[model samples]
Target: MSIDRVVEQIRTSVFSYKKLADRLAERPSERVRAMIYLKEIAAEYNLGTIEKFKNLLSFTLVKLYDDIDFSLPTGLDLERIVKENNVVFVPNHQSHADYLILSYVLFDRFKFIPLIAGGINLNIFPIGDLFRKSGCFFIRRSFNNNILYKLTLEAYISHLLSSGHAIEFFYEGGRSRSGRLLPPKYGMFQILIETHSQLDPAVRRPLLFIPISIVHEIVPEQGALTRELEGL
Candidate 1:
């Protein structure tokens, strides 16, 4: 049997097991709860086990090209970073593939590194659900001016960082419309530092800032940026 077929069989078996477990018990155990969560996420995202298998397969394809020379380092020291301190993996955003690239590198090569991603906008189709289930939380991009909401968001981020979660975010708030490095936005970083300061010294883990430099021979979005720049 092919690898894809094997993955499909595993997913189907798991789903069947979850259904049986749910029917047999009044209240599910933690393991069952976790399975239910995954099932819900997959269903909401319109992702069957087959779709997720495809995403992983896509990740594999990207990995094949991960080592292509770009005059900069591609491999991240995620294990070392996670072992020693709390980290925010800040990388320059260039392609839509950035998240998958980083995720594959960290998870496949270095083991499980949990990352918190900025949630996709609600208007986006099925993919948004996929991203959310894939470990992203929503943030209101336009609510930067709302003080209460901003503080709440910061607090949540602080809580995540303080708990030693390996977080990843683009320093450039959004994808650069222009294919150039934009200035770093410190909103997330500031929250992390402020939260760190409030924690007792003995309990606080030092926050490590690891800058990921992604160099591509060609910017995938160069055409869009060029058109905008030329006022075309």
Candidate 2:
């Protein structure tokens, strides 16, 4: 599928006014304000510019960082497994560049990309919109006891798996800015684990969990991390 088509699909898959409104209706008292907030956000999100954003972001990131590379095996038979099973990529989070690097690799090697979950706060301006079109579905961190929100997210994830789409999420939720390997937060990973039973019985034997780690000899964000840690 073309990037524009896929991006449009991803955009609607997450932000549907009808669906969100219906979900918000579950909590009658909160519907009015929630709808107002949703309306504003819905306007803020745009799919038209996203296609250009993806092409530019990938090209720009790849060109700017010459030292980036991966540790994936040279002759591992991942393609056959990828065809037979729904794979879940569990990668260590280290830098903001991680997703850009991974997307670049997938784009170059496989010619296909996977949709993943991200926070809605990243749905803001230029960079955030760039990320959205790059196959990310934005979500809120705190669900606020909103059952509708939780169920919607779970349903969306389930749909992606049942359709044989490869899934990915940071095993630690986000980067360990302190420069430490974090204890697995199990945030987005829990969705797959929880809904394992709901997957198609015939092809659900092994949900391939590909554990990948991308590293850099000199982290470009080291200084920024240190300053943030020091409460700058």
Candidate 3:
């Protein structure tokens, strides 16, 4: 059998098993069902369980993007970066393909990198749902005053980092409405610091911050971003 056939079979079997398990487990909500399915697959694969689902998702993403002509930078030591340290990948946001591109570069080359994404109304769709199941937690975009929500997010992020998962996120809050790199938002940084502070000194791990810059010579949304930035 071809590799493509094998991969498709795996995907089908996993999804089918997940559906059956969700039904048996009495998970009534779609969101919850999806979450359960992810956890089950993660466990079955022995890839670190649900707690490490983000890494598994990153692996899947890299495979998906490899079908394209995506390639990683040369002479960069990906293994040492991903395997040896708790990494926080901060990339400049540009295209909608940022997630797939980065995931492909990291996983296809280095192996595993877990990514986090903002959960907003706009992210609710088939692709969004796929990301969430693959291990992306949603963050509320406008929860400016929601202290409880902020704390919960912080805690979850801390938990993941402390457990040795490599994290990837866009530091520029949202995608650049302009072609230029927007000033970095300190929310994610602040949360990382706070989480670091709370870690028991004896059990703490070194966190490595990696900044990735992606430059597209010709942006597809240049016109749209220019218009949006002008209005701002």
lDDT digits (tens) for residues 105-169 of candidate 3: 55555666465554454345665545554445566666568543454455455556556677777
Error of 2 at 98 (Å): 0.3
Please identify which of the two predictions, 1 or 3, would achieve the higher lDDT against the true structure: 3
Provide TM-scores for the models.
0.64, 0.73, 0.64
Question: Measured by TM-score, how close is model 2 to the native structure?
Answer: 0.73
How many times do residue backbones clash in model 1? 0
What lDDT would each prediction earn against the true structure? Answer: 0.57, 0.63, 0.58
Task: Give me the runs in candidate 2 sitting further than 4 Å from their true place.
Answer: 1-59, 202-205
Best by TM-score: 2
> Model 1 — which ten-residue stretch has the worst lDDT?
38-47
Question: Which pairs of residues collide in model 1?
Answer: none
Backbone clash pairs in model 3 (N, Cα, C under 3 Å; residues 3+ apart or in different chains), count: 1
Which stretch of 10 consecutive residues in model 3 shows the poorest summed lDDT?
37-46
Positional deviation of residue 150's Cα in model 2 after best superposition, in angstroms: 0.8
Number of clashes recorded per candidate: 0, 0, 1
Clashing pairs in 3: 119-139
Q: What's the residue-level lDDT of 135 in candidate 2?
A: 69
- If the candidates were sorted by their lDDT against the true structure, best first, what order would they fall in? 2, 3, 1
lDDT per residue as tens, model 1, 1-232? 3323433433433333323335435443444443433332221112243346346756676655555432234675556658778777788888776666666555545655455456435315676655655555556555566543444444445546555677778888777644679888877777667766765466568788778887666666777788888899
Q: Residue 162: error of model 2 in Å?
A: 1.1
